[model samples]
Target: MLRYVIDVVEMLDTPKTSGASLAEFLRSQGAENAEIMVKTIEGEEGLSTDFVRVFIPGSRGKSSGGSAPTLGIIGRLGGAGARPERIGFVSDGDGCAAALSAAAKLLNMSAQGDVLPGDVIITTHVTGWAPTEPHDPVPFMGSPVDMETMNDFEVEAEMDAIVSIDTTKGNRTINHRGIAISPTVKSGYILRPSEDLVSVTETVTGVNAVVFPLATQDITPYGNDLHHVNSILQPAVATDAPVVGVAITTAVPVAGCATGASHATDIELASRFAIETAKYFGAGQISFYDADQFAHLVSLYGEATHLQTLGRTK
Candidate 1:
């Protein structure tokens, strides 16, 4: 499985690449339903990139009158291949690499007769030359498209729950080797961390689950001069579904676009964790958040969905 991830990283780390190559790679691995769409965005340094989406239908299949929920596993990254300044895949691409790895693993598993109960849809964009931005502690990777553009394509209606994975090494908050999970966010409300996911993480890694400390501002929309821990929680602003971040962390602060910084072992751990989560989550063995409790909170506090939008003034 790790070899699959390495293969993906090497393939995506090229200068002239698109989602077509990724789609082909996954197809070669038996992902027959994979699709690719490239949109020309003016902001991506004039680079037209591709958005790749791979659907591994459950045993019942979504359109086949199946009752199982669909899980959206999004690989959040500034770019897969940061070119020119950075010659190959950057540290920020860990999320995309891990997501693709999980997709490949799941497809292989299904081919080998280990199918999940619900569908798993993985989405992410590929760009070779993404811009960079300056930050306080370290330089960060900038996307060719804005956050709004990313949210528009990554967040979809069919996803009952979402796991947004990003490279979180530029901050000093988390100091771990493998990865950390964030508190579940739904419709702008941050709920108690899901113990079920923690147990799943522990079971997968054989170690205690590490949760990244999150604040109210963390789940809000990006920009507005407000500081974000990272883009890990950005998907929460675009959907009412429960969203959790799977952060690829490090022991110290590392710039997002830094080359020669990706650790394959750490990425493998994150990919395996995602695979485990997908397996149990689709089987109804995991709960992202209690819907009844969230409804009760909504009733008590009114609509916090306003957090999902940019602030407006009269």
Candidate 2:
């Protein structure tokens, strides 16, 4: 619901906020099982900020020997805003908002005795101010920390699959409202769209789901002097699990650091989609890809997981 989106935005729009207090806020919302931790790593750019980890252990609890698969919902963003230059929360923060809102909804559902079958871990940082970087189409939000640090904090081994949500407004390739789902990415190959995810999208939106195309460079590690479609695929490089991008798109390209660009309704739609996906994933009703098929592909063409790393030095 839009109320959830608005609630998260109001909480994180403070002058100097951190994940510690934000975690407390979620606790007050009945996410008593949620865990929060902050990580800070300095990059060469001399910019540093806290990267937050919020883990909401499901009813079966992965650590408790739950057979159900664990689903990781990562809020991918550069920063919420750029401080004085960009006063309020920017478009990039949509991922953080959507992830939190979905967590809140799930927790509320659990409170009502409809807990998910598997574990759901939600992670993202709450940086009120972040740096901006220049790109080909438009300026992008530069992370306060580095990409390696982010992946280290966000991607966990317990996660069997990942839904990397990011604001993809800075591209003209996808000119639509609401959100779009990228094809499933596992190991290193960009495989066909996951039929399960596509069905979930259609059932939720009541419209044929849109797929945003991905280039090879898009899935590569950041800071390689290569252009990325967006950071939606960044998590793929850090995990062996299958990763899919949940894009918050618009009809026209929008800068990630642009202020006054966040739309609550659009965010609500994306959040709901994430929540639904988590539900199915935890229930084992959906699979990122058929394990048998993926293994066959690997046998035919060899391993593509190396693409998930920095690759061999020349």
Candidate 3:
């Protein structure tokens, strides 16, 4: 995990990194059995970015004819770098780095006999010249595309549950210098943390679980007039399947575009956690949320799908 993190960070700490380059790197790392796709998407004001999607199939996973659940691992980030403004890989790139590292590790495992039981879909964007935006405590690395465009590309229909990993250090939410997770979010409802997921976190980190603070606005669609902690939970707005956020955090607020602030060990920790989660989640050993309770919530109250949209005009 650490090796992959170091390699990815080194590769991405450039002004020429693109999705195609990262896809090639994965292929070189024994991804022959996986289905990988790279698309260059252009959004807002001629801004363009590369998106990479990798599907690592499980023996009994949906990619085949089996019925095992598929887990989506998304390296949710605004951009990997600020380019001319900031010269190196920013803190925001941690999510993409950790996620791609997990994909690489899984490919290595597949090269051996450690195949999982379910399919895993991993996606993230690569952008080196993203812009910056002013925020409260620190500035954010703005993406080349909007949240909706990211959702369209990264959020796959085959994903039964999603683990959205993003750098959550730009806010004063969780004051930890490691990884934290958000509760299971589905259909606009912020459910409790999955005990199974929490256990996985504990097993990987060898420490108590740290839950990232979240608000309703955080899970809502971006572009709305609301204060989101960050885009960590934005994937929830794009899928009915339960989504959990794995946040790379810091004890103090840090700008998303801040250079020389990324910790490979922490990113490696998050990568290990995601890989373990995929192993357990694909085997049907755990769930993202309680199905019965979620049904009851829907039965007790109507759908909160409205919260997923931008809502009616003011």
lDDT scores in order: 0.84, 0.84, 0.91
Clashing pairs in 3: none
**Which ranges in model 3 have alpha carbons more than 4 Å from their true place?**
none
Give the C-alpha miss distance for residue 241 in model 3, angstroms: 0.4
Using all chains and alpha carbons, the TM-scores for the candidates as numbered come to: 0.95, 0.95, 0.98
For candidate 2, write residues 65-165 as lDDT tens digits: 87888999999998887886788888899998898888777777776677788888888877876888887688889887888888988899988999998
Q: What is the lDDT of candidate 3?
A: 0.91
lDDT rank, highest first?
3, 2, 1
Q: Write the per-residue lDDT of candidate 1 for residues 146-205, one digit (tens) a residue.
A: 889888888999999998888999988899878899989998888988999899778877
Give the Å error, residue 296, model 3: 0.9
Worst 10 residues of 1 by lDDT: 31-40
Give me the candidate number with maximum lDDT: 3
Better of 2 and 3 by lDDT: 3
Where is model 2 poorest over a 10-residue stretch in terms of lDDT? 31-40
| RMSD to true structure for each model, in Å | 1.7, 1.6, 0.9
Q: Of the candidates numbered 2 and 3, which has the greater TM-score value?
A: 3
- lDDT, model 3, position 253: 97
